[model samples]
Structures are given as C-alpha cells and as structure tokens.
Target: MKLQVTGSISELLTGISHLSEELNFTIGSDGYPISVVKRPGPIEVKNANGQGEICFEKKIHFYRALGLWLQNFEKSKEFHIVEHPQFETSGVMIDASRNAVLTTDGIQMLLRKMAVMGLNLAMLYTEDTYEVPEYPYFGYMRGRYSEIEIKICDDYAEELGIEMIPCIQTLAHLKEALKWNYSNEFRDTESILLAGEPKTYEFLRTIIKSATKPYRSNRIHIGMDEAHELGLGKYLELNGYHNRFEIMNQHLKQVIHITEDLDLKPMIWSDMYFRLASKVGNYYDKDATIPEEIIKMIPNVQMVYWDYYHTEESHYEKMLTMHKLLVDEPIFAGGLWTWNGIAPNYGKAFRTTEAALKANKKFGIKEVFATMWGDNGAETPIQTVLPGMQLYAEYTYHQEVGPEHLAERFEFCTGYHLEDFLLLNHFDETPGVMKDNLYESNPSKFLLWQDILIGLYDKNIEGFPIAQHYEKLIQPLHDAKGKNHDMNLLFHFYEELARVLSVKAELGINLKNAYDQADKDAVHACSEKLSSLRKDVEKLRLAHKKLWFSTNKPFGWEVLDIRYGGLLTRIHSAEERVQEWLDDPTVRIEELEAERLFYNGIYTFGEEGTLGRNLYHRIVSNSVFSD
Candidate 1:
C-alpha cells in the first residue's frame, strides 16, 4: 500500500511506512492508494473510484483513520466510515521501572501499534529506570534508558503523532534508586525522599530536569502517590512528627516551582490527597472529607486519578465524582491488567476498561490512558496485552461496540487472531475459575512457583482438575506459534508454560495423597515425575528468557532467572526427600503430614473462590522474602 501525504500528516508516513514490510504490502504505483488529509473534526474515511481518502482531526486520528480504512479496504467495493474520538489525550503508560525495561526497538514497535489504535499519548513509567547524569546509582544494574535512547523513542512517538511524556518520580517509589550507599543523606525511608531536607529539593530538581530533557512534550508526570512514610523516617527524628499534609503540601510547592522554572506542566497522582482526607487513609474513601482550608490551598497541578481493580461502573463513577471535588477536571488512568502474573488477564482488563471509560465519558473527563504496570518481576510478555489495548481503542471511539467488531478491528490492526491472543488466559482462567475472574486470581503463577513439598495452594485445588485444564491448552498454544509468525516467540513461551503447569499443577497433591495412603508405588511415580518436571521447568525458563531478551533489556532477566533457579533447586529437594522416604519407610516425610488450607485463609473452594494473588514470594512461602 502507498500513502500520499500533505502538511502535518507527512511525518507519520515514516512512522507507518515500516508497516509496508511487516504487513507484507508493496508500496508501488499499482498498490492501493491512501490520501492522507488533516483537519479539525472527527476521523472521516471515504472510498471512491480506486483511492481511499482519510481525513483526520488530529495527528493521532490519521493513524486510526488509516487503520479503519485498511480494515474495510478490499472487502467492500466502496464505503464511508466516520469515528469520533472521545478523549483529547488517550494512550498507554508502560511501567519501565519494574524489572523489565523495554528495549528502544520494542518501544518503537509499540508506538506503531499505538498509532494504529488512534491513541495520542504515550508515557514511560520510569521511577529509576532513566539515566540521571549526576547520579550513577539511580538505576544501578537496572537497564535504565540513556538520554539518547529516550530521545529516539520520543522522536519515534512524534513521527507517529503521539505525545511521549516523561513519567518520573520526584517524591516516593524510588526504593531501587535510593538503596545505594550514596543516597543515605537524602533518603528518609527505603522509598520516600526526605521531603523537609534542603538537599532533597536539589536532588528533585536534578532528577526532574534530567527526566524531561529528552522529550518534546511540556508535560511531566511527577509521581507523588503512595508516600505512606512521608514523615515517619528520618524526618520524624529531625522535625519531631510534623503534620504529613503540611509536609506533602510544602514538598509539592517546591516540586512545582522546579517544573515552572523549566516551563513544563506537572501532574501528580491524586492518591495522597485522598488518602490524607480519608478517615482510614484509603484512596477510594467515599466519605472522605478535606478541610475547607486544605481544599482552598490545593495547587493548580493536574490530578491523575488511577483505578485498575474496580469491576463496577459505580465505583469509577463514585471515584470520579470524588476526584472532581479535588480538581474540577481530573485525568483518568485505568489498568491494562498485565501486572497480574505470567499471563495477561484479559477478563479483568476488559471489565475494568469498559466500566471505567464509560464513567470517564459520563463525567465529561477529556483525558484518559491505561497503565501496563509490571508488578512482581514483570514476567508476562508485554505484547500479550494487545487485545486489551484494542479493547481500549474501541471504547475510545465508540460508546459501545460488539464483540465481532472488536475482533475484526483487532485482526486489522494486528495480523493475529483475537482468539489465539485470548487463549493465553486459559493458563489461569481454568475450570475452577469464575466466569468474570473479578478477584484477580492467578493460579498458574502460584502453582508453578509454589513449594510443591509444602503445597501451599494444593489443598485449595485438590478436587479440581487444574492439571487437565493446562494439558488441554498445550497443543493449541503450541500450534498457535506457526499461525502468528512473528509472535512465535510469545506463543512458544506460552506453550512451554502450559507444558510445565500440566505436570507441576497437581504434583504436590498427588504426592501428598499417595504418602497419606501409604501407597509406596504412587509416591515412587511422583518422584519420577518430579525429575521430568525439572526438565520442563528448565525449558520454560529458557523460553521465557529468550522472549524477554527479544523485547526487553537484559538487565531485568536476572531477577526472573533467580526465581527459575529457586524453583529448580526446590524440585531437586523434593526429589531427594521423596527418594529418602521411599528407601527408609521409618524416616517419615514431615511436610506430607502438613494440612493444606484455602489460599485466601477461609474462602470455600468453589464458585467465586479465588486466591486473587499475583506475588511470587507470597505463593512460595509464608516466610519473609522480597518486600
């Protein structure tokens, strides 16, 4: 396909031209023609004679118009489609601070997808994963992006007509950056900065300047949320328990002054303000009240209200209403649900997006974006969140769209099947799982990483056929690799995940049951199965490692490597313990006698019952691990 461009839309041709190679389309005189036009209205596409005319209101709208045109290109003889975008600034915020920092190439790849989806905003959530010229240990051993890398990504986003804003932290969420010995002077606690300290403002200024230098956007997201230890650490020792609200407000004024000096607009997470107002310090407190003086003293910075877990529209509506009390118009940030576990939770993501975006529309909020946060090691492949992104894109333009329309648009934007991308969810959404999966249940992750000997989640899954569920998904995921072509790496990882879970899911249950029954033969079989499972674990680790390296920087893979090695060592331990028990019946297996309990403490093991956990440390043991 060939694109004829004019005015501002011409820059996007370079950004989207690569699609010619990826989508296997030839750009020639005889190829399909798309005339790009820019104006100030809804995205309008019309086909007449032999060429397609794509008229868009914004630069971001052009890419979306092109996608819509392509979706109906050859199928229809002649047609017209008009899509009106709801939000002014809508896109994604990739969590680069988590273990996985996307490579520059991967960021460019995603920009294309964002352009296709008609999203105009892009943010890289880098707490410490961006280079600070003066601080060498800011992102030590973390694959932090250099100035050149950030510049390249921002340039690519510009070509795609997307606003790439630098999302950095000026207050808390800097545990990785602050743990080094050099940070002792300014650090109040592990994660929070010493807000009252004189040097803290200087440090904040340096980081804020460094973070914004590579981007063209005048906007910066200054993360000031979840700073629970604001005055509880060294600040308490120095100031003798100062009021947290006063401390926070003073810190905000200092940070805002820096941003103002740099000629930039700043946005802060609204959680801290709401938390201080709440009776119990909850961000979503419905009855939370702010003192009249405090309300009058609120700064002019943008208040970003982020909600990811809500499955109900009423909760978003209620939260949005509360946010307005803080700021006249608040920017809404929803979650893409990629942070859950090894696989993306499409069910939870779709439910939350629909519910939240609808609330955003009803409230007349103009700005929105979904966050792809990588909590707990960031194991899930980022590309698996495509269908969820598509869902957000559809909701951005239409009040409502049918399943068939979403699927068709998805296939057009991404040359892959929606069902195949969705099949990745089967790892966790197995037989015992609920229809909506509202509880954030992630059995696949806990099952694979849990101590098989102790069997933490074994009792919860004793009666359910979870292993059989994984077995059923093995072949489909394995076969999907060839169908997806470029996505073979992701599917191969998924296939290996299914392979590992098929055996590992019920290994502890079978072994413990056999030990209780005094069935020496069944116990022996379980031991042999552990040996084979070790090989499968190794395969899964290699598959995941390969996939990670292909998309992300090599720095983060070490964290996951440690996790894989731990599971392998525990499996070997299980084998040795089982062998010792088989040889000497007199020496009893202490762990096998231990009783299993429900994962959520007291929930029944049936409908709507779920672990709702995604943290690996919690799944593996009750002891203290990573904090």
Candidate 2:
C-alpha cells in the first residue's frame, strides 16, 4: 500500500503517523504534496498528533483508512466510512432523452452506487420521461417516465444524501412528443426550433414548470447544447433569422426566464461559452465550433463545462481556456471518459481524472460529474460502469499524489490486472478475432493495440446495426424483398460501415507513411494502435453476429414474440455465412459494406418505385410533424 500527503509541513507528518500502524507503510516526507511518497515497511508511528494534515492519492490507502474504522468495530456495529469535515458531492447527467431509456431498476441501481461514492447530486436528462401528469400526452412515445417512477427514484436519491436534478432537453430532440401532433402552441410555424414549434421558448417554459413542481433542487440543467440544426429554411423564412448565434441566445434567454420564474437556478451546458472563447491554439478554429453568444452570456447563468475525453491533452488544455474565459459563477463539470453501453474507457478516464484533479486545483472547478451516457438505449447494463466510477470517486475525492502513483492503488481497489481490468472493465471486450488481427499485423503492438481498440469500440455503437443488417441481408438474400427489408436497420448499417471503413483507411495511411520514418517509441505506439483497431473490428463482427442471430428470436422476448426469434433464425444459411467472416476483419469489413450497398440498392431500384408496406409506413409515420 502507498499513500502521498499534501498540505502544511506539520499536517503532512501528523497524517502519516495517524495511519502508520494501519497502512503498514513508511511515509517519506518531502516538503510539498508531490514530494511525499509512501513505501511498504513495518508499521511505525512517531509524532502523528501534530497540527498538520495529509491526503492520500492511492485509494487502497484511503480504503485502509476506512478499514481502520471498520477494524475497530465495537461488537456488531461500525461505520463504513469515517466522517470528514468536507461532504462529498457528485453531479451526474444521464441523457435518457435521446431514444435511450433507463429503466426504474437501472435508476435505483445507479443511485445505490452514487451513494457509495458519496455523490450527492444526480440528474436524469429526460425529454419524454417524467412528464407532468396534467399534460399526460406531452412527451408521448419519447417521454416514457411517469411522475411516480421519478418520485421513487427521487426519494431514494434523497435518502442517500444525493439530490436528483431532472434534466430536460426542452428545445431540440423533442421529436418524440412532436410526432404526436398534439400541440397548437406554435403549430403554424416551421418545426425548426423544437417540440414541433418554431416558438421553442414556450415549449421550454412548460417543461420547466412541470419538472420543477415536484423536484426541490434549485439547480436544473436545461440542456441547450447541440442545437446544430437551428434556423434552417422555415426559421429563416419566418423572419430572416440567418444569425444562429442571435437565435441561440434568444432561446437561452427565454429558458433562463422560465428558470427564474420557477424560482430555480439554471445550469446549462457551457459549450456555448467555450465556443466563444479564444481558439486557444491553432488546432481549434472559432468558426468550426459553438457560437460566441455562449461566452458573452454564460456569466449571467450557472454553467456546466462537459468534455468526456479529458485524458487527451488537447481536451484538458481547452478546458483550461474555458475556465479562464468564464471567471465568474460556480463553474463545475467533469471530463467524460465512458458513455454508451460499451466498457468504460479507463485510459482516457484515468488520464482525464488525473488532469481534472490538477485542473480543479488550477481552475477552481468546485464540482464534477463522471458521465455514463445511455446512447443506444439500455442495451448494456448501467452497472457495467460502476467500477470505473469508483476509480474516479477515489481520485476526485482523495488527492495526494501524481497520476502514476494512483495506478497501483487502482489495481488494489478493483482486484483486476491493471491493463486487463482497464480493457475489460472500461472498454469493449475485443472479440477473439480482433486480437488475432493485431497478432497478425504486428506482434509488438499486441498489448497496447488490444487495449486501445477496446476503448474505441466502447465509444462506437456501429456494431449493433452492422450485425443486424448483415443478418437481414444474409437471411433470405435470394428471396427477401420490400417490407422484409428493414430500412432503419440498413441505414444504420451503411452509416456504421462507412465510419469503420474510414477508420481502417486512416489506419492504413498512417501505417504506410509512419512505419518507415518512425522512431522506436513511435513505431511501438503505432503498432499498438493498429492492434487495438483490429480488436475493435473483431468485436464489431461479433456484435454483428449477436444482433443478426437474435433479431427474430431475442433471448428475453419469448413472452412478447414467440415466433420472431424462430423466424429470424430460420433464414437458411444466414448464420453460417456470417460465421465464416467471424475470424477475418478484412473479409468482415468488405462483406458488411457490400451487404449495406445491396440493401440500399434494393430500396432505391428506381427513382419513384412504389415503396414496400414497411418502408411506406416508416416514411409516412416519420414524415409528419408532431407536438
């Protein structure tokens, strides 16, 4: 076990002796926080009851701190953690608004983990979930949460010393409720703004009112980020509103008004502020990113600066620029590393967290959130992210050493090999084939590439559709037609196939140019990158097979569709053909892309060819504007 302490000279020495007996290590004191290092030794104590204090960078030491309390249990009762002067607070925002819906069970499970980490704040970004009972149909299909379910989650969170902050995507991504065509508030205007109306302000007000009524937290995150498709043809035609910045600002002000009226403090995504900040360096151009309106108006409101890939030096640097820009308000947000259902990207997570701690000290960011997004619905379990979150909780709360020193502590807390644990716990499990590709490409790059590829795959959700469509096309290649061809599945397959192919092309180019000119370190890194990429491809193939084979006969859906699974599997020879490319990335990539084009060709045989029943229904149902 190792522990590093920082602070006043006296406090540092005192803290060391306080834990000397329990930690079974010797503390070599250096003047600064970075100087103190813990080494294994016989338990020793001297002058611990002094005026100075110490903090630990290693979590096992922190765990040992808690274990000290546990070990001194009187009879049958003891506290899991010793009470400290500073209370731990965590803020999380789950984007359930985007087609992904987290179940009540998932919410309960998340709250339980948050409490363990001493997280005191939680937010569920719901567009359709937790609709106001008075306006029952407001959210419709997209808004699936009931007030009862929300209250249940809310009550549990409160009990755990965590406040549940409900996040609502008021303006954009409101297509779920808009499709119902249930509101006439701004029905006449083109639906560019959001919620089926050009007048997005009013829609936001209604949502705010509904959410704030039951929840008591004054801080609410009104997600005004990613309004990319703003002020198009209709919005432009209505009043010559070509200026997106002006329009975005107007919408933000309107939302702010609603928040004020509700007697609540608003927390909006700080992308707009960061957008306006100086490009920091040549890598970022002001024109390519968010509008400047954010930087100008952010001081007036509380802001959350969110970036999940903080481990990347570039991202951390940008965050510093943003903090400098917004020298006002209680600025608090986290560097995100893991999201979606893929494994947690630990390398990025660890790098980002370490950066955040240094960042927190440098920029004075008071609060942070480690985001776990449900991008592709609840296809993967929320519990999968807990281990990674625990690592962050330790890093964020207990800070005494550098990033390298915390690594050993991480292995002890998680009970898994550091590399394998990071790869398995935080990244997508590379299917056997991906590993094979790396071994074939460059044996030296085997370990690093495998690990890196897992993280990349976790972030990418293309495997789901790639697997689904390939199965569809292969199932009845000779006989399938029209309605049987799932357009949604095919479109996703094409998109993902393109992305994967693009990455492969990029990798090939890098290998060709860099291999000859690279230094030893560069070559080793590149080899590892290639290996990881291969593993990602392998996992993609496996995911494809899993989805394709289960389309009709989903494992747990026997009660809902008894014949669906059987019918899907019955497509003679589909399974066998897919299995053939399971061991080959090149073949897997080629066949999937070919199948995507084939599916596209089948649908677009002629310019105005009559559409199949399935396509027809999808087109019509998806075309109309809703409330």
Candidate 3:
C-alpha cells in the first residue's frame, strides 16, 4: 500500500522515519497527487482512488490529517474525513519520577505515535527525576534526565510537531526531592518545603530554573497539590501557627514571583484550593466553597482541574464550574488509567475519559491533556496504556466516537489491535470486581503481592473463581503477543504475570484451609506448590526485568528487585514452615491457625466487603514496611 505524494512533507519525514514500523504504507512524496495544503479551518482528508490532498491549518494537524488519510486509504476504503478539534491543545503527560524513567529513544518513540494520534503536547512529570546543577543530591541516582538528555528529547518532540513542556513540583510532593540529609534544613515535614524560609525559596528558585531551561515552551506545570501537612512541621517551629490557606497563598505568591521572573506562564493543580475549601479536605466535596478574598489573592496562573476518578459528566461539570470561579477558563487534565497497580485499568480509564472529555467540551475548555501517572513503584509498563491514550486522542477531534471507529483507528495508526490491547485489562478486572469499583480494586496487584501464609485479601476474594480467571487470560495475551510483535515484550510480561497469579492467587487459601482442618496430605501438596510458585515468580520477575530495562532506565529496577526478592524469600520461608508442621503435628502451624479477619487496609478504598488495595507496602505485610 505505497502511496506517492506530489508535495514535499520533508518536515514530517524525520518523525515518520522514526515511526516506520507502525506505518503500513510507504510514501514516495513525488508520485501521488495526494498533496498537503494549509487551510484556515478544520483538518480534512479527502482520498478518492488513492489520490487526494490533506488540508490542515496547523503543522501538527497536517500529521493528524495524514493519519486520517491513511486510516481509510490503506484499508482500500475511500475517506472524506473532517476534524474540528474540541480543545486547542490535546496531549499526554508521562509520570517519569516513580522509578521508571523512559530512555531518551523511548520518549521519541512515544512522541512519534502522539503526532499520528493528533496529540500535540507532552509533559514529562519529573518530581526529582531531572538534574539541578548546584545540588548534587537533587535527583542524584534517581535516574534524573540530564540537561542533554532532555534537550535531545525536546528536539525529537519538536520535529514531530509536539510541544514538550516542563512540568515540575514547586511546592509539596517533593519527598523524593528532599529525602537526603543535604535537604533536611529546608524540609517543612518530610516532603513539603518550608513555606517562608529564605533557604526554601532559594532551593525552589534553583530547582525551577533547572527544570525549565531545556524546554522551548514557556508553559510549565508548577505542581502544588497534596501538600496536606503544609505548615504543621518545621514551618510551625520557625514561624508560629498560621492558617493553612494563608501559608499556601504566601508560598504560592513566592513561587509565582520566580516564574514571572523567568518569563514563564504556569499552571498549578486545582485540588489544593478545593481541598482547603472543604471541611473534610476532600477534593471532590460538592458542598465545598472558597472565600472570595482568597480567590482574588490567587496569582494569575492557569488552574488545572485534574479529575480522573469520576464516571459521570455532571461531576466534571461541577468541578469545572468551581475552577471557573477562580479563572475564566481552566485547563482540564484528565487521566489515562496507568497508575493503579500491576496492570492498567481500562474499565475505569475509558468510562472516566468519555465522561470528563464530554464535560470539558461543554465547558469550552481550550486546552486538555490526559495524565498517565505511574503510582506505586510504576509496576505497570507504560506501553499497556496505548488504548487509553487513543481514547483521549480520539475525543480531541470528534464529538462522538464509536467503538468500531476507535478500534480501527488505533489498529491503523499503531499496527496493534484494540481488542488485544484491551485484553490486558482483564489482568485487573477479575471476579468480585465490578465496573463501579474498578480503580479501587487492583486484584491483579494485591492478589499477586499478598503473602502466602498471612492471607490478607484471601477471605474477601473467597468463593469466587478468581484463580480460573488468570488461567483463562494466559493464551489470549500470548496470541496478542504474536500479533503485536512491536510490543511483544510488554505482552510477555503480562502473560508471565497471569501465569504466576493463576497459581498464587489461591495458594494461600488452599494452604490455610488445609491447615485449619489438620489435613497433612493437603499440607504436603502445598509445600510442593510453593516450590513451583517460586519458580513461577522468578520467571515473572525475569520477564518484567527484561521489559523494564528495554523500555526504562536501570535505576528503578532495583526497587522492584527488592520487591521480587522479598516475595521469593517469604515463599521459601512458608515452605519450610509447612514442612516443619508436616514433620510433627505437635508443632502447630501458628500462621495458618489464626482466624483471618475481614481486612481492607487504610491505604486504599476501605469499602465494606471490598478487596481493593494498591501499594507494595500494604500488599506485602500488615506490619510497618519501612521507617
């Protein structure tokens, strides 16, 4: 399906070359009468008999129009597509701070896909994952992108018609940034910097200067969200008790002054304002109200209303109205569900993106981007969220998107089936999991990481054939891997993960049940299963290790190494205990004898009868994980 073009698309040739594997057809640039023309309106692709032109106003839209041109023409179908973009700016922000920073080449690979998907911006969310010149400990050994690495990525993105903006935390969420002994003097608590300290402002100025120097865009995301302990720590010791709102505003004013000095336009997370307005400090409290005086004092920075948990359009509309109360039109930041646990939760991502984007369209949000955060050590591969990315990219140009259309568009642009990428969602959407409870319940994570002897979530998931669920998922992921050779490494990780979870999901339940009944034969069988489970876990770890190194930096791999090592050691100890119990009935199996309580730790949504949990610390044990 090679198409010859009449006009030169030399500017996009570099990016297209980078994305050669995903392209189904070759372009000669001189033979096909299909030309590119700059128009003043919506992007249009008119293809009839493999000869037509792509009309687009913006440079990025040209690439997007080309995607439209190929979507139908490559499949031997005529296409006359017109796209009116709903948002002025549509893109994605990658969370690179949580131990899984993508290599420079990987960022380029993603940028190429973004160009074809009609996405125009990318934010590298690096809390402490980028370098600061003066401070050696600043992002030291955390796989922080050097200034050169960022410059290279920026150049690559620029060639692809994508704006790579610098997004960093100016205040709070800096626990990793200030974890070392060198940063102790400026810490308000563990993560929050002192609000008014001269040294704190100095640190902020240096880090802010370091963060934005590599990017061409003047737009920056200055994160000031989730600073729950704003003035309760050393800030109180330095300057007596003050209202949290006053402290926040004063700190914000100082930070804004720095951005203004740098000639940068900034946006801060709108959650802190909403959280402070509520009595219970909930960001989504419908009854929350902010005082008019405080709104006036807010500096002239764009408010980013990032809502990812809602399923209804009305919820987004309410929050958007609240943001408009502060500014005329706030930039909406929705999420693609890559942050949950071991797998991406597409059930939640699709539902929430559809609802949130609809609200954004109604509210006339000019700019919108989807956030793909890597929470909880970033266990899930970022590649698993391609379908979620397509969901956001599709909503940018069309008011209504059909399922078949999205699937076809994704397959054409990515060379991977939407249904196969979607099959990865079943890794988390097992039995006892309902659509109403998708984000909170990461059965794929907790069940895999849950202790064998302790049985933390075993009782809640009891009587459901959850083990059979993972067993059924293996071959489909295998088939998907065969079809998606480009991302087969990612598919292999999930396939092995399903293999491990299939056996380990109910291992503790079986062992504990037998121990309670004093069934010695069943206990012996559990010991043999433990030996095989260790091998399965090792296989899963190796599979994940291969995927991580191929896609990410080597620094964060150590954290997961510790997690896998802990699980293996714990399983080995469980085997020894079972053998000891089998050797002598007098020596009781104390761990299995304890009556399992209905447990839902406070780390996650502690709903009644819900087995949802995330975070490695909570999954590993009931005791304190680290000091």
Model 2 per-residue lDDT tens digits across residues 490-522: 223223333333344233223323333433454
Report lDDT (CA) for all predictions.
0.86, 0.44, 0.86
In candidate 3, which residue pairs get closer than 3 Å at backbone N, Cα or C atoms, i.e. clash? 4-32, 5-32
Clashing pairs in 1: none
Clashes of each: 0, 21, 2
Candidate 2: clashing residue pairs, number: 21
Q: Which parts of model 2 are misplaced by more than 4 Å? A: 1-68, 71-88, 98-100, 183-199, 273-299, 312-318, 330-332, 335-342, 400-627
Candidates' TM-scores?
A: 0.96, 0.56, 0.97
Give me candidate 3's TM-score against the actual structure.
Answer: 0.97
The alpha-carbon deviation from the true structure for residue 488 of candidate 3, after best TM-score superposition, in angstroms, is: 1.5
TM-score: the better of candidates 1 and 3: 3
State the local distance difference test value for candidate 3. 0.86
Residue 416's lDDT within candidate 1 is 86
Q: Which scores higher on TM-score, 2 or 3?
A: 3
Give candidate 3 misplaced runs (Cα > 4 Å): 8-10, 604-609
